[model samples]
Target: KAEVDTSALQNEAIQLSSASGHADVVKLLLKNPRVDPSEKHNFAIRRASMKGYVEVVKILLDDERVDPSVLNNNAILLASRYGHAEVVKILLTDSRVDPSADNNEAMLWAVENDHSGVLKVLLGDSRVDPSEQNNYAIRRASELGYVECVKMLLQNSRVDPSCRSNNAIKHASENGHVEIVKILLNDPRVDPSACTNYAIRHASENGHVKVVKILLQDSRVDPSVRDNYALRHASKNGHADVVKILLEDSRVD
Candidate 1:
């Protein structure tokens, strides 16, 4: 009878977790020796964590059996993806939790969602590398014109402003993020002219006047160094404004 009762309570707790994400029910079930807090049920505490239920998370985390570093669970990744700032905070503070886990997936999630607040928290921890490669966090944030995130990433001395990527300056210029373009331009290490003709032509053709102006003013930029392909593209696309700017400069014509 006791075993059946315990199973019933555990089942009820799971249902409650699924619907309400309440900590009280989770705690009650956890108190039963037969109830497995870490059970892989659909409505487990881990899922609650992903849903941003801080109270339920605290209850689950208190159990010695719960692994704070677990990843890829719908709950954990969802929490990160949705910008559950508080849950992320609690997880990171755990001694057993790995801040750099999942290839810094949490950071990428925060950036993709444009969660500036959560990003600030993650950035404050030195263990989180702002310059990690190929993740949408850095590139997407720059593309989306999240200036604060860009600044935070730039603050890391190890972050290479000129990190070569198809989307780097091209995206920034096309989006009319003048400040980001300016920041990239000022970085001595960034090769503003590295991308293919499409990127340059796009920047030029869009009449991103300020971007063109900045690029032209840079002494390092070879106004005459035309990648034949890009020049033809600019002309073919009928970006007359860009062509005019290019032609106005004696070096380009």
Candidate 2:
């Protein structure tokens, strides 16, 4: 017979079982009507989800008494941050789960952690807004040179390719992500002169010669714009190769 204990005992057992990924123990404890799923800072499901205990998560979700929506700093958010794709998938099935909740903060967490697997799951959900302003996902991905993540986010129809906040192109250029720069530049909506022509300036300052050349190829980019900030940055940073390239542009005053 399953032992039904007091609230405190049940809470402790549930927390330990969930944290340890003890699916069997969790199942047994959850069967008790006295066991509170929301106990212990609402960590029961969050811990299981974070650790990628798919079976445990399924068990918890299946219980009619369990409030799957208990965010507890976002169970899905924690799952995504830790790169638990399976766990994230389970959470998405809950109708109350908000992919864009907390200002789409979960997606930002996934991007910052470079958890593309979890990101993919999150992006697939129509509910997840890809264009949250200054959310570090795209910016961080571009800066760190995560080509696939950038591509995925771009393909999502909801995401604006030329979001100025944490500008993707500028971050890519600043971090010397040549391929990413090319990708963003190819997007017709993206403005090379956006962010006060920071794209070119970043490429120049970082000595990303390849990226600089790519940006210049875009006819819309006036290298001499912003008092030739790109040129100045290249010179100041001692990026001789970038400076050489800039000098060749007739637009440079």
Candidate 3:
């Protein structure tokens, strides 16, 4: 019974030390052959990854028995989600680690949460597919105003600024991300009026006066498209500034 209790404590001990960056303690605990990381689903490595404990992660990865890709690459996901570039890099070096694990969720979290560094590292890995979900990374980054992240993803040949239906510019314009909108426009592939003028309507309805003006400036965007949807929404949403801009457009009746 005593041995059974000690075995249980081993997993907990490693988890605590790994999470706290106690690299030395983790090493000592691992010396005991009974400390099986897989017992708790390799959570200790994940904790270290999430905390950006470079040394702790390296120590754990060095152990041949440790599997960093367990639980659908949860370790890399946590590291990428938390913007731990160093931890992600170390984990990638492990032969068993798949950077594209869990359908490339690690990169998605890094992109969505504005972790450009981690995203960059993940992008460098050929295993990562930036365009896996129809250019999801670029669109989300544009919408969230993550300019740097958007730029990085845009440079990736696989990513399209304007995918089949959903577009990065459309999302950016809707949320008044001026910088991102401009960046997307610079990409010739992006059609500002991709979604039946919904981009302009969303901007107008949300009272994004600056974004509305930017859309109108683009000759390709039909201010009066969708039966004058942009003007109608602006009026209904009580966006006087946006309404004024729309009225100035010759196309808006």
Worst 10 residues of 1 by lDDT: 222-231
Q: lDDT, candidate 2, residue 186?
A: 74
> What TM-score does each of the candidates earn?
0.77, 0.85, 0.90
What C-alpha lDDT does candidate 2 achieve relative to the native structure? Answer: 0.81
lDDT tens digits by residue: candidate 2, 19-76: 8899999888877777887775577887888888999889888876565567544788
lDDT of 3 by residue, 1-253 (tens): 4354424775787888888999999888888887875557888898899999999999988888788988888999999999999999999888788989888999999998999999999999999999988778887898899999998998889998888565678778888998898788888888888778778889998999988888888888898988888899889989999999999988899
Give the poorly placed runs of model 3, Cα more than 4 Å off: 1-10
Error of 3 at 221 (Å): 1.2
lDDT of each: 0.67, 0.81, 0.87
TM-score of candidate 2 to 2 decimals: 0.85
**Model 1 ranges with Cα > 4 A deviation:** 1-12, 15-19, 27-34, 41-43, 71-76, 134-137, 165-167, 174-176, 195-199, 227-232
RMSD of each: 3.7, 3.1, 2.5
Off by over 4 Å in 2: 1-10, 31-34, 134-140
Global Cα lDDT for candidate 3: 0.87
Best-to-worst order by TM-score is 3, 2, 1
